[model samples]
Target chain A: MAVYTEIADEELERFLAGYELGALLSVKGIAEGVENSNYLIVTEAGPHILTLYEKRVDPTDLPFFIGLMEHLAARGLTCPQPVRNRAGEALGVLAGRPAAIVTFLEGMWIRRPRVEHCAQVGEALAQLHLAGEGFAIHRRNALSVDSWRPLFQRSEEGADTVLPELGAAILRELDHLEQNWPRDLPAGVIHADLFPDNVFFLKGHLSGLIDFYFACNDFLAYDVAIGLNAWCFEADGALNITKARALLAGYQRVRPLGADEIAALPLLARGSALRFLLTRLYDWLNVPPGALVAPKDPLEYWRKLRFHQSVDDAGAYGMDL
Target chain B: MAVYTEIADEELERFLAGYELGALLSVKGIAEGVENSNYLIVTEAGPHILTLYEKRVDPTDLPFFIGLMEHLAARGLTCPQPVRNRAGEALGVLAGRPAAIVTFLEGMWIRRPRVEHCAQVGEALAQLHLAGEGFAIHRRNALSVDSWRPLFQRSEEGADTVLPELGAAILRELDHLEQNWPRDLPAGVIHADLFPDNVFFLKGHLSGLIDFYFACNDFLAYDVAIGLNAWCFEADGALNITKARALLAGYQRVRPLGADEIAALPLLARGSALRFLLTRLYDWLNVPPGALVAPKDPLEYWRKLRFHQSVDDAGAYGMDL
Candidate 1:
């Protein structure tokens, strides 16, 4: 039996043959991943990325994804726009898997991200949130706190592996989080995965962003918290003041944060941390034996979730913003 | 096409037809996941979890999983053991996927864990490390420093989205990380995914551990660092003093740490923080469309990683072992 599968190049080529692009030069399967098979396609009209949906992706969601990206792009968000075929549909089958082409974003994602890089992400996130003001499509924040209890149910048997007291603590945290969760904040579309790789830059200037798969309507500050969690952390688990300040400052420049956003940051951060801890915890329980998929260390998010529980002040995360 | 596929009752029943345990009662696929399709299976053999390997699991590693559980079970680690079939193999094919039966543990993972609870986890972790030494199999820590580059590459495309300075900071951190990464320390198999859920308990005592997907050889202190990253954090992105002390004290009680391990902890913590930051950052870049996967808030990790970079002493991380 096949351990892993991928879409065929010829199949992908056949699917793209009907696209509007004048020429397709490169169709390279990027070997750098374990999820979807992605081909970097260079065309005479322009460069684009073709991704063959893998097992993790449900084929039915293809339209939603394509539509989401197109919607965000139309809203002035700098994300990949799905290309339509002669049928004016972005959804198509390639290699027996649902697939489509997305315009290749131009800037290289910095592997060696610096403190200031986080600030730029903060700015882009602010813009993304602002641009998401009236997006036609919507998706529930799938990893929200309301869903934690069910995730807990799946791993309930192994609760002792964490602690006999954990069940209560988790429930308590959830309750506390529920009571204290931020409300009355700027709500809008968010690039829920604003990791450095998803945001692009060129010659010291913001270029475009890609990968809006997790985009959803949520708290604006939660987006900032996600960026803070990703961009400002040091290797030893310390919060970099300079990086945090830079990110906040940059974000405020484009879209000044409101008081409620600041007030809600601590809880938002906790919620976000818990979200990761839960998912990583779930994945940790069930990673495949031989699959190269790297299992995320839930311990880190566990710590962050615990840390976020301690925060009461907005300043604890950064300068008030 | 089935948006959520069901494990056929006939197939599931036949799969368990002749088990010494008895007749099947019910099985329901649990969704809200990206990997395995888990069924809450109840049979004459008793209630057990039926996990259908989906996207991420490779079949070859099933034996290691099967073996590891058996080994842990022998060593008194409370965990689910893979049930062998009538043919005597622990693994089987089902629904076009690799499958297994694991006795469901009973309990709930704590979300808002207390300092005392963290202390318990710390002690349990040390015990796990001690028990890990006797396991027959050996696998090098795959998530060692070598893993960071691939993750960095994944996020390299959109590096400047957050900040241009972040790229330099990341390279500097990596360089500093390489220089300070611990090479000389106690090495043994680790329950690498030792989050709260993986641990099981009855009332107040630790009972069992479940997920061993990330088990491997690495600096024992690295495991401590993992714990520190998990249990010693505050909600506002700072370290929790009491929880930190409790956990470290508990760990030291069972397995006294070396001075070198103690001294190297600040760096170790930083490395641990970076490991998660890079992975989280990479995940941030790669969320699949239409999937329920939530992109973890990278900002919290960013905060933790930056903190690690700031620490110059193990004491900063509350290491006393």
Candidate 2:
């Protein structure tokens, strides 16, 4: 829960002057996003999200992120459409940070996502992948297989402090992934972080997907792998085959996977697991003193990686090639 | 920014089963309140705040706080009226914490409060005091003069760790206040923590007062003192006489101050300052390891206490006695 920057009434009034959004009724700092300051902005017209991109987000990459939302939104996807000002620009500056207002989507991200929720999310993910077909801009997946080594190196020295065998385990996984990672398959813009938190639902129906900051050009099937790792796991650290089958079946309903994509699922899943594990390990080892956000348990991803290592075929994930 | 407790969608749905509020639309965790987990709950009926009272709040005091809001709102004060569920209960349990749904008031708390804002706050405060005449629930001020010594003792040993002469300075101030603190004044249920953040304004008009957790029986003028300390201080720590005058004048317009209450303003302000200082000092010295909330600067209150010490007359605040 964070609102790192405070926007004053006078400043907000001045900032909204550029937009056709009517009189500001209220502005509340939402504590959802970790990478930016988000406010639920209500105007005389309607509710919108006013986001001030923080230092964690690269200003240059914002065009890709905002443009992706616009592109996908225009393509019949239910995402937050970036509200352009009267001057036809979607982005502006406020409180010394790059800011923009997007139409507020009405849905809650389900916690304890059931099998049906997983299926809805799967369908939404496929829809998002299809919607990105014609987007002009590109953003590279920064936390992909290639970047794991650097992140691992940064956290390696103190990795054992969290767990005795963490450093050695990471090294072994990194070596195995770098050599065996899938090289060729279907690729497009994927929501690299399609965790349950980023997917919203309205009464068992997929309302929309959000947080496009992590969307980038990557193997579209790799996104499916990420979703499998994210959504197919139970609270007890066991894989739920029914949910996995439902999610994959839901996705296939919209866009069927190719034979090569199906064959490469296990390897892609391992790579996806390793990518998250390295990043989490890095964050866990390097959490600054007095940080507002508690570093998530890196061991969770470590266990997920181990499970992926044990799986030798796509059929184990409740899918058949 | 706080949402210590995470409420699951299922848990929330079950909790709302008793409420007549239509199907839930969204619930966004609000990062505003310090002593609770607040979510901006949007349902088919309308917007409301779902607050889970945190550990800092004593569950026994829930009745007083909740009842005060109900009474005040019923008397035409525009505060958050507690929403009763189908069972006609304003408070229930959710996520293992005491929870309630309150009507969502529309307005923003001004960050840089102008004189007009201060005046509105003063008038609203007076209205609140007037409206509270018949409230049956009685809660004693927990941070009043008698409680300061115990709080000071808790932080006394390490007080000098924060500053060289701080420990001795606090003892001296406590000695002065204990000997001369007023025993006779207009006493009533006061909004004991009427900081600027607790007051809301809509388009420069005073909307309402909120956060009744700190409401308790105390000297009526002491609430004014708390407001003066909170609202009259400029960014540079200097007192703004214009704002103070506006606040006091606005209060006088609704409820005229007694001669004794006017005479006791300086001392009450000093006591108010010390009360906050001691609590902040204790918190600053004892912030638990890995605590989500950062301890506020105790020295800010020390500075306010010192400024109040320099004032020889109530006129120094702005209005003529």
Candidate 3:
């Protein structure tokens, strides 16, 4: 719901001259993506997403993000392929911000993702992990276990205000995780923020995955843990084991989980939960005055973290080692 | 940038059951139209806009607005044509709000409209007035002179806080307008809010007009006044006579202005300024806590009102009476 930079018509026309995208037909600011401004731009050729990287996105990390899309898409994974300009560059400047156009994926992200949708997401996640092999660039997952302490420190002062004793609860969880976090698992590029909104579907089939800004080098099995935390929880903070089994079965069918990865699922799930909980807590505590985007309830992740803490084995997720 | 209603996938599928639009391809909430939740929905047929009318819009006026678009489009005006469902209905309920699908127009609204764009807008506006002649459903202009006082009353208490002596100045202008408001003029369906954003352009030609929520029966020349105030003013609050001349000339070419309509342009412009001023003032003083949409500066309209008050004749607008 952000269009931080407004591209002037003349400037846009000039920018399009460097591309073979044909004449511009329409450009609309889309209410999607929070980190950058996105426009569903239609040219004489077809529809594409025009993204202007805002201050939130580090310009240095864009090559990794854009190139990953290209690499994955070339391997038959459905994702937004960055459109290179005639000058042979995938990125350019528009409206005084780094911008690029990517081919538009044709499907809507399902809201209330059913068991079937979860299975499809699981399969897609595995495919993405496989397709991401041998990427030239490397980016460390900035919001991983190591970043949680500093992130929590920023929000710890006011976390109790949101929920009674929430700060103490978070500190206890963070201490437990910092000491017990898994040190080794199968690692590769993982879409760290593959929420339901980032996965698009059409006719009950997963059409594509989007929002690669959070993709980075992390344990591939940790990606599955993130998906489990995101997709297996019902609105009332209860785990839906049937959907979790379906998602895990779907992923295993594509890329079988190793014994160690299966053994470490609970610990990885706790770390994933803590990652989101800290970030959400930070945002909740630091919402600037007059900010348009409402900070999400941080306690949702708190509930998920507590559930993961209660599970001592992967069997709780309806999966067998 | 508002998508107030989040339509569920199952609900959207059920809603699309009534349309011949083929299978749904994608639906993205678009950041357009302040009064409604608009989505750029693509089905097998093609792109269309799905608008869910919010509470700000009266449900009873749905027929008049939708009917006006259908009538105007059928009469050869380039606007969004309402798409009827299998039941031959253009409006239906979706997400518990009145909703409709309309053909998507291919053009972007110019950010900084030049003289040519102003002229094109003028000609298109004249054509709209002509095309709207035989529309059967008539709606009185809700924000007309008769409503200004009551509207101003809501904001009068804090209007001075926005600017020095602003409330007193508004009262004086309201008195003058009520005493000398034009009683007789060529009246018809006018696009009462024809700001640049409502007028789209493609390759430098006006492609279409949109946002018909404010359409109602009003003085045709009054619409022209709104266009002039909207399109012919510079960023620094000075009038651009060249653009104003071009807009008026273009309108004259399509349908000649009557002598009375020409004579009343200055006063109509003043009333138009006041209309926008009072509304903006109300919004400025009454912005709801945590509201996403920022209220536009009310004093911008105040400056325009002052300029209109200083003009004594139509010549100031570059039109000869």
Report per-candidate TM-score of chain A alone: 0.89, 0.97, 0.98
DockQ comparisons of all candidates to the true complex: 0.01, 0.76, 0.79
Off by over 4 Å in 1: A1-321, B1-5, B30-35, B162-164
Docking class of 2: medium
Show what share of the native A-B interface contacts model 1 retains.
0.00
- Tens digits of per-residue lDDT, candidate 3, B98-155, equal 9999999999999999999999999999999999999999899999999999999999
RMSDs, each prediction?
27.8, 1.2, 1.2
If you assessed candidate 3 against the hidden native complex, which CAPRI class would it receive?
medium
Could you give the interface RMSD of candidate 3 in angstroms?
1.2
Instruction: Considering the two chains of model 1, state its CAPRI-style docking category.
Output: incorrect
TM-score of each: 0.49, 0.98, 0.98
Per DockQ, what order, best first?
Answer: 3, 2, 1
lDDT of every model, 2 decimals: 0.70, 0.89, 0.92
Roughly what TM-score does model 3 have, to 2 decimal places? Answer: 0.98
Summarize candidate 1's per-residue lDDT along B1-321 as a digit string, tens digits.
002334543466578874656765434343222346665555656557677776565666566667887877777767777787778877787877888888766543444567877888888888878777776777766677877766687787765575566666777888887776777788887776676656654444566677666677788888888888876788799988788788888988988888888888878777777777777676677765433344556657678888877877777756643
Total clashes, candidate 2?
A: 0
Interface RMSD, in order shown = 23.2, 1.4, 1.2
Cα lDDT tens digits, model 2, A1-321, are 433688877889999988998888877888788789899988888889999998888999999999999999989999999999999999999999999999999899988988998888889899999999989998998889888898888988989998898889888888888898878889999999999888888887889889999899999999999999899998878889999999999999999999989888888988888888877888787777667777788778778888988998889889965
* Poorest 10 consecutive residues by lDDT, candidate 2 chain B: B1-10
Q: Tell me the tens digit of each residue's lDDT in model 3 across A1-321.
A: 433577889999999889998999999988778788899999998999999998878999999999999999999999999999998999999999999999999999988988998898889999999999999999999998888999899988998898999889888988888898888889999999999889999898999999999999999999999999899899999999999999999999899999999989999999999898888888888877656566788889989999999998999998975
- Candidate 1, residues A146-261, lDDT tens digits: the string is 78778777765665575556556667777888777766677777777777667666645667887766667778888898887777767676677688788888899999888878
